[model samples]
Target chain A: MTQSAGLVAEAILPTFTEAVELHKSMVFSIAWHFLRDRSRAEELSQDVFLELHRRWGSLRSAEHLVFWLRKVTGNRAIDMIRSRKVRPETSLDAAAEPTTLEQMHDSLLASYLERMVATLPEKQRLAIVMRYQEDLEPDEIARILGMNVSTVKTNIARALSLLQAKTVGRLQPNTARRLNEMPGETGK
Target chain B: MTPFEQELKRALARQQPSADFTERLFARIEEEQAAAPVRWWQRIAQWPAQTIWALAPVCVLILLTSGTMLYTQHRRAVQGEHAKQQLLLALRITSNKLQATQRQVNEVESERQPNQKDNIRRLL
Candidate 1:
C-alpha cells in the first residue's frame, strides 16, 4: 500500500525502487533528447537517479520528487555540455540546413528535431527540452532553471524561431509566412 | 498550438530508454552508495523518513534518561567527597581535644609527686 501511489494525504511515500521504475522514461528521454547520444543519455540519466537516491532523505512528496528529477537532470546535462564543451555530432553550423521536414518521414522529422534541439545553446536547449519533452509551463521551466519566467519565454521563443527558420525554408511560401505571422509565444 | 509547435512537442515526447534502464539505475545507485565514504550518522539519516520519525521520540527519551542518570551519579560522587571531608575534620578536632585532656592529667600527677616529696621530708 505504501509503495503504491500515495492516495491518502498521510500515506507513506513510494519506495526508491518504485520511484526509479515510475520515472525512468521521463528522465531517460530528457537526457536522450538533450544530449542526442544513446550511451551518454543512459549514463547521464542513471547519474540523475543515483543522485536522487542519495538525496532521498530530503524528498518531501511525489511532486517534489518530480521537480528534483527534472531540475537535476536539466542542470547536469547542461553542465556536462558546458564542462566538456560538446558540440553536436552533426554540425548545424556547417551542414546544410534541414529544409525538407515536410516530406521527411515522421521518425526522421522527430530525429531531426531532436538533433536540432541538442545543438541549441545550453540554456535554450534545456528550456526547449523541459518545455516540450516534459510539457512544462514556462513558469515551471523558469523555476526549474532558476531563471525569470520572461527569460524562459524568451529562450523558448528564440529556440523555436531558429528551428522554424531552418526547417521552414523548404515549406510552401504561404505556409511558412502563416507560421511566421502567428505570434510564436504559444508557450506563454 | 501551431503545427510547427505541435511537431516539436511530438518529436520530443518522452520515450523509454533501453529496456534495462531501471535495473541499470538501481545497480548504479548501489555502486554509488558503496563507493561513498562511510559516515555512521549518515547511515541513520539515509533511513526512510517514517523510520526516523518513529524512532525520534524514543531516541530523545533514551538520551534524556541517560543524561539525567549521569548527572545524578556525578552529584552523588561530589556529595560523598564532601561528607568524607566533614568526617575527617570532625575526627581531627576530637583527637586534638583528647590530647589536650591527657596533657592536663599528666601535669597534675607531676605536681602531686613534688608535694608528696615535701610532706615526707617534714615527717622524717
Candidate 2:
C-alpha cells in the first residue's frame, strides 16, 4: 500500500462512518418496511452503507448522499425481492381471518397493512413504502424509481385503494352493518 | 387526513433498526477496510489473485483445443504415411512378380531353342 492512498482512505473513513451513522435509520427503515424482516433489512442496509463508502467521492452533498442511499437501497431491495421471488405469505384475498376490525389492535392492523403492502405488485409496494415510510413526494419517488411522476402517483393511489377496500369491505358482517348505520361510512 | 390513510402512514412509518445496528455496521466496515487493498500497488498485486479462478477455465480450454488440433494433424499424417507405404509395397510386389514371370519365359524360350538346334543338327 502506498502512503498517499492509505492516507486518503484514512481521511475518508471518518466521513463514511459519519454518513452511515446519520443515515442508518433511513436506509435500515427502507429495507425493513419493504422486506418486513429485521435481519434481512439489517444485512441489506449494511451493504448499502458499504456501497456508499465505496462511492463516496461521487456524492456531492449531504442531500446527494441521502439521495444516493435511497436510490441504491430501494433498487437493491427491489432486486432482492425479484431475485428471491419473495412475496407476502398471504394475499389479502387468500388470508384466513379470525380477527375482526374491533378485535385487531392498532399495531396489529398496521402489521396487517404492512403484510398487505408486501403482497402488492413490486412497483405499487415500493411506491407505498416510499410515500408512507420516507414521506417522499411522488415526483421524488419517480426520480428515484426512474418512473414517470404520474406512474408513481398511480401506483400509490392504487395501493391505497386496495388497502382501503380490503380493510373496509371485508369487515365482519355485524360490524359492517353497525359501522355503516352509525356513520357516513366513507371508509376512507 | 382520512383515518385509513393515516393508519397506512402509521403502519409504514420508518423505525430505527435494532440498537446494535450501527455497531455491527461499523464493525463490518472496519473489517472490510482492513481486508481491502489500501493502495494502487496493493490493488495491482491482488488483481491476478482475485481473477485467477476466472482465468483458469479459459487457459484450460485453450490447451485442450490446441492439443486436439495437434493430435488430429499428427494422426492424419500418420494415416497418409501408412497408406503410402502400403501402396509402395504393392507396387514393388507387382514389379517383382512381373520380373519373375519374364525370367521364367526367357528360360523356357532358351530351353526350346536348344531343343530346336539339336533337332536341326540331327536333320543335317
Candidate 3:
C-alpha cells in the first residue's frame, strides 16, 4: 500500500507542477491586467492556482484545463473588481527617455493604448484582453466568459471604438491623425 | 488588426508569475496538509489540503452526532440494567413473602389434625 501510494504521489506531483509551470503566465497576466495591482494580482493568481489544485481531478484534458483556467481567472478578476470597487488607474503620461529613438515612439503608443484598454468597462476590458492579449477567438472568449459569441464580438468591437475615440479625442490633431492611420483604427 | 490593437497586444502580452510562485504555492500546500485532520479516506484519495479545511465543519458535525448517539445508547443500557435489577429484587421479595405464607398454612393444618383426632377418640 505504501509503495503504491508513493508511486501515485510521484506521478501526480510532477503532473501538477508541470501544469502550474505551463499556465502560470496566463493566470498571472489575466489577474495583473484586470487588477493592475502587482501584489493583488500575484495574490489572486496564487489563489486561482490553489483552487485549480483542489479541482484538478475534475479536469479531463489539457484543453479543458486551459479553458478552466481562463474561465476561473477571468471570473475571479471580475469578482475582485466588483468586490473592491477598484477605480481604473489612468495616469499614463510618464514616459521614460528611451535609450534608442526608434523604440521610443512605439513604446509610448503601446503604453498609451494599454492605459486606454485598462480604463474600459470591466466586461469590455476583459473581452479585449482575452481577444488581443490572450489571442483567443471570439468563440473561445464567449465560452470562457459564459456569454454569447456575438456578444463577445460586440464587446470587442465596442471596446475598440471606445478606445479609438478616447485616444484620438485626447491627442493633438496631427498625432490623432497619425494614430487613426494605425492599422487598429481600420477595424480589421 | 489595427496598429493600435497590435500595439495593445504587444504591450499587454502574458506576464509570468514571480520566480518563486510555484515554490510558495507548494509550501502553502504542505502547511495545509500538515494542519488538516488525518483520515484514511482522505489519505487514500489524496485529497487536496484545502478540501480538508472545507470539510472540517462536516467532520465536526458527524463526530457530534455519533457521540450523542453513543451516549444515548449507553444511557439506555444503564437504565435497562437498573430496571432489570429492580425487577429481580421485587421478584425475590415476592418469593420470600409467598414462602412465609406457605409455612403459616402448614402450621395451621398440623394444629387442626391433632384436634380432630382427639375429638374422634372421645366420641367412640
Candidate chain B TM-scores, in order: 0.70, 0.54, 0.61
Off by over 4 Å in 3: A1-14, A91-104, A170-178, A182-188, B38-124
> Clashing residue pairs in candidate 2, if any?
none
Q: Which of candidates 2 and 3 is the stronger one according to lDDT?
A: 3
1 or 3, which is superior by TM-score? 1
- lDDT by residue for model 3 over A115-186, one digit each (tens)? 667777889989988887777788888999999988988898888877776556555556666657743342
DockQ of each: 0.33, 0.18, 0.24
Question: Native contacts retained per candidate?
Answer: 0.69, 0.48, 0.59
Q: Could you give the CAPRI-style class of model 3?
A: acceptable
Interface RMSD (Å) of candidate 3:
6.2
lDDT of 1 at A39: 89
Pairs clashing within candidate 1: none
lDDT of each: 0.80, 0.74, 0.75
Model 1: lDDT of residue A25: 81
Tens-digit lDDT track for model 1 on A44-87?
99889878877888787787787888899888888877788767
Lowest summed lDDT across 10 adjacent residues in model 3 chain A is found at A1-10
Q: After superposition, how far is residue B109 of candidate 2 from its true place, in Å?
A: 89
Which digits, one per residue and each the tens of the lDDT, describe model 2 over residues A58-166?
5555566666888899999999888987666787678666556557666877887788887888888888887877767788889989999989877887787777777
Q: State the TM-score for model 1.
A: 0.70
